[model samples]
Target: MTQAAYEHNGRSVERAAFYAIACDPRRSIAVEACAGAGKTWMLVSRILRALLEGSLAKDGHGVQAHEILAITFTKKAAGEMRQRLNEWLVEFAQAPPEKLAAELLARGVPPAQIAAQAPALQNLYPQLLASARPVQIRTFHSWFAALLRTAPLAVLQDLGLPANYSLLEDDTEAITAVWARFYATVVDSPSARADFEALVAVHGRFQAHKALGAALNKRVEFVLADAQGVVDASVPPFDAQFPAFAGLAAPEDLLWAQRPLLQEAAGNLGRASAVTFSAAGSALEQALTAHDADAVLAALLTQKGTARKFGEKIVGIATVRAAQELALQVAQAQLQHAAWAHQQRMARLTRVLIAELASLKYERGWVDMNDVERAASVMLSDPVLSGWVQERLDAKVKHLLIDEFQDTSPLQWQALHAWLSGYAGAAGAPSVFIVGDPKQS
Candidate 1:
């Protein structure tokens, strides 16, 4: 074969070998590759083989429709997988014997066994449709919601959720309503109002809203952090003293003390090289006049808070040296101050936002996808409830296939691990097949 043709044939051989391992129904595997590398194809093939093999199931029949749970990252992906699986099953069911045998062989079936598997493959489509419970192909959130729905009534009541709680796929309306409630309540609350003003002053109203929305989207993370006491205790209060630079005073005090030296240096630098130093000089002069420690710190350092360089010769001057020394101290102090202020404001805002959102959700009998995931995870983790939940899931599902597994949240993975832990090395344990592009994650 020519070089190009030889390389192509080699790739085909490699792919065949890979599929042999990946598509084996008995083996659990995780497939990670870049997009368009047939991760989904391998997943679907594995599902098919599991159905055909039938050895994993309690009955002689292969994994039933309801026994296989296939989860995707998105609804669109779930729909696509469901469609492709159905299409292939239909083709297998209707194709001529030779064609059907060829297809089965290509899907990693041994030649001698094609006839035996062909009958089952041909019957799969109708069996799937006629089965009392259809195969589950769902997004992670949807699957979690379904799991939550199966929780006992007492569990639902303990979680402060209605039995028939509606899922909020789009939480825009709820967020807006929560913000309305926040605005209404902030007027009467001094600390909340101060926190709101601080956030608004820094981010403006529109950006502040967007920031809070982003935080809300990651509320699970916030919840986890809060449970660990990281939110309130991690950042010290803004006004609290922080040790730095031989017990240097506050940034504001340092800035006021160094103003005269900074003013002198600015004038000398401006006169020495107008084009090079005029902007820095003007900024320093303005900040000194305004007695603004933040602005002075900004003028004295790079945006990232490194010491501002005004050439070796210029910086060697006594006034400039003194001013630079003070700048270094102020920059260190001010950076800490900024961090502390930000942590405080965000902690306050996020806490309030989470509270208001939960209140609104409770009032409306609505739960977002995060809520479902969290509730399911909690249910799976509870010592009392986990056994019952595991028993129910073990009876229903025999194989678990997760598409875009890398995109699964920590909580979702935790829940999956918790449930799957019970089945480890046990009889008829559900086989797991995970596929994803880590690059995409």
Candidate 2:
């Protein structure tokens, strides 16, 4: 992990890059790693360099193990990092000199230097382990929870909640109960009852449960902004909605009329139809004799015979053109109505759901994981409290390492950024290292 250990006879571009970042103690580093690129190895190498040589050196003057903060997205990652550091330290310390030399030599260290440095490196065994033990490596949520636990008074005061509030680990049961109660309450009200029934009649199901879950899980709080302009719900006239189909085609201009394919079929009433065995010829014989647009359209749209390639062509070119135009018009009208209905329903339910959840939270004096993050973010928004928290964190942490930076949401970033800014601005600012894949996130 020492800077000198990385000076070797041969090095891959990846290894050189790792050493470059890990060896440099003056500047911050941000890495955008692709999948299976050994992100964990790179991160651990950086941590080790900081511990054995850079900031958290074995010398009494280096930063303490507890001072370096490594934040990742999952508890499993945190455990892996801690385990890796511990194992590497133990392996290098106790292993035979030949074994240690093999490890160092494999890393491109000169053969002569590997044996020479092995003994000195062995001395760092106890120090590295002791230093790593107190190092703060945790998932972002776990870190935030720790922060809140450390200074609950300020966060509680800002949230307008008592200090004794508990975090409801599994909020599904509570949310379900609240949903049931809210539905029952709404159903008893005359206007609400009417709207609820109408929603079910129109959509055939209640979507509020799924909708609320989706909304709550988002990183940013949604503001249900009013529609930018007035919604014109009145159905547009057929001509306005579908200009091509709006103009009625005369019976003679119809595809069947011009082509007279049905007339041909009618001439040979018992001829083999397109499907060979189906009675399409007889059906066409009946429709062609009628010579009505309605009958032609009905036969074109609904008759199974019209589905065949030959049958479709026999429907007449003009008739097919007319049918396509009318079909598009119908489909567009239905789609527009469906979209509008969904938006209106979602808008109405979002407001109701937000209000209900707020009431529930207030009455219960409990919050979920999302609430914890949100509350911490809100508390950090105030300049005074943010400054206080910043000063508190600045006094302890010397380096900040973040993993899965892409998945870090805006709210989480806001809180972390505030502290990062404070740390960056301070004298002898700490190194801020971030690793992530934007594509994966």
Candidate 3:
């Protein structure tokens, strides 16, 4: 049977790959198609090829058949991409297999068997395959989130808790609990106490600082589950594990690719990042630091990248300005939610316990960035969390596929790197496939 040949739009790297792919399929290639180069069209074909080849089948010992993970920059993009893929599948499905076979031969796919699969390609193929078997198609965030949810359930069970215990909704919330427990366990340790004291000195209060700490501990719980009882049981007792937060592989494991960069920027900041500023400084102080016209020029160029390091710095200042804007927005939103909740907690305030929301915010205990950075830093840097996350990645998938490579944060990428390092150390495994648009950077 023949396969479809891509319509050319001059020199698309994706075109080269597409021709080669229609000739023969490979997983590690990047399709560097520019705008109007039919990148999405090619993307649809790649997915179809994967599906026809039984790579989408889940009831296998070899190739994975689970729903292909597709991630795009926006919810709209994802929807459009899914719709297009379905439409193409149906289009191909409606065509006679013999005609498609001739078409494949005329275009490229000479596989005698591939034509047989064409009739199997229905618009409902994804849905039918998913229902009859196990197929899923979801954006990256949604799927990873589901995995994250399952991770903790495995952890709590490993910790020997009652069977009915469930993982929490937010990782930050769970981490707070675990770190509180960790602190309770380690209160007497001389070094731990000294460190705790140092934090109190700088921050004004030493009590109730385990928000993200507990978050990482919750990660530990999941790692233990992956191990099936291999982690050191004596290190600490997790009354509740951080099942949602699987410590990522390692920093370097994340690629400096475009997709990751966008993912991080969008997921973390609603499509904005540190590069949003166009002023000399994110704050007026920065503008004042510059001398004369060069400073003004630099500030003007601050929102974007430049040829020199100075330009980059200027652009970075713009990003800082952008961050400030974002922070203000977040602060405003949080204040409203917290204030309303505070009022409810007080319930017609009058006495001290029932006073205004401000009093309650201070009295009832709350956490912010300080707690998040400190605790997450500890768990991620720890030997146990890093080791366990790497092992799980290596054990779960023979191939590592990461999307939105450019938008991955340094910390998040590091988690994947740690895993890759471990995999390379072990040998006989695939190196991570990092794909994304550098132009998007």
Candidate 4:
């Protein structure tokens, strides 16, 4: 924006402070974006501001370019952030390498050296000509999952997972399913059932999955209490596989495992219980009985208004965002099968219930399917997973953004509050943005 435009369309002092910090070589702020606050515009402006102010400069030391990290919570959002930021910077800089070089020189970045580096940033931004460096951003969990796939040791150590277990070779699912089965058995007892059911009632099932993921990730790598429990396994050699360093594992992690939400769950119990069995049964039955079963199918396949609304609210949230994806899945799917004209909706809902029964057989999935559910179960069983995820998150970000704050799973909130409150001291600490519509929650 021009000086005049900036003056006329002045952002709030806090937002301007965000711009300044994002632009400046130092300083980072956590911004709570109220509704309609133009978060996208701000993100774009910050990227442009950083580029214009020489934040993209790669000095001889080679540290500055890689120093800054911007993390969002979802794949779609991350991509949008990168594209918008890149496009804004490219257009603002005249959509050409020469323009960037000239600006870099004007900023006293050493004309000769900047001429070379400017081409890189220009190409790297993706809005311009192609080059090499990734001058953009990533989701937090994605980056970590990549770390796990590549240098499993470093990633594990960083997250404090097992130092010795093979992240890839070990089947964390096998471990988790055993625990979940045991949990079910134990819960069958009157006292155990109350506490177990109570756990679900108090927290959501998703939190349990997260806890399960954490536990298995640790047992495989860090602590195998019984040598008897050790199951020898083999995965392709690290060299034979794609390098995880390049951010390859991230998209897959999100697409399949809902890793970000699971990662956040660490020790939270909200995932398993927020929508209790009572709620699910009632919602499912009411939904199925309310509509013609055949009509429900027609509505879904035909993209009718009712189905669309349900999908937008629930599916859109889960698939696009980390905070509400699972909840969205449950809510939307329930809605989808609710509007039955005949027995169709009831049949579908019945299938949904049956689907969970055999889900135990698989221990991994692309979309937190039955398999990933098992992995999540292991995470809840293990305490170390939470610590490990906590460690990884603590190590990287300087800021955190939470959504649906009022309904935040207790375990997830505890970790977040603790970390934001200074679990890592001031160094590399993340500023926090907590945003939620409490009434909606």
| Candidate 3 lDDT, 1-441, residue by residue in tens | 643344333433443444545333344445443456455555555455555555334576433434344444446666776787666655666777676665444333546655555554543455544554332344444533343323334542433333333333233553333444445434755754555555455444533243223323334333333246433332222111222112423111111112233222223322223454322233223333332323322433333423112233332334434433433333333344344433232221111111122122223343222222222333334456545543553334433444445655444455445534554456444323344556775
Give per-residue CA lDDT, model 2, range 187-295, as digits (tens): 7777666656666676556464565567544413543123222223333433355454345332233334344554553344334345541354455556567755445
lDDT of each: 0.76, 0.59, 0.40, 0.40
Worst 10 residues of 2 by lDDT: 223-232
Candidate 2 TM-score versus the reference: 0.62
Report RMSD for candidate 1: 5.5
Sort every candidate by lDDT, greatest first: 1, 2, 3, 4
Candidate 1 TM-score to native: 0.77
Quality of model 2 by C-alpha lDDT? 0.59
| True lDDT of residue 262, candidate 3 | 21
Worst 10 residues of 4 by lDDT: 231-240
- Which regions of candidate 1 are displaced past 4 Å? 1-13, 55-62, 126-130, 153-159, 232-323, 421-428
Evaluation by TM-score, superior candidate among 2 and 3: 2
Error of 2 at 411 (Å): 2.9
- Report each candidate's C-alpha RMSD, comma-separated, in the order given: 5.5, 9.3, 20.9, 23.1
Using Cα atoms with residue i matched to residue i, what is each candidate's TM-score against the true structure?
Answer: 0.77, 0.62, 0.39, 0.36
TM-score: model 4 vs. ground truth: 0.36
Displacement of residue 251 (Cα, Å) in model 4 is 57
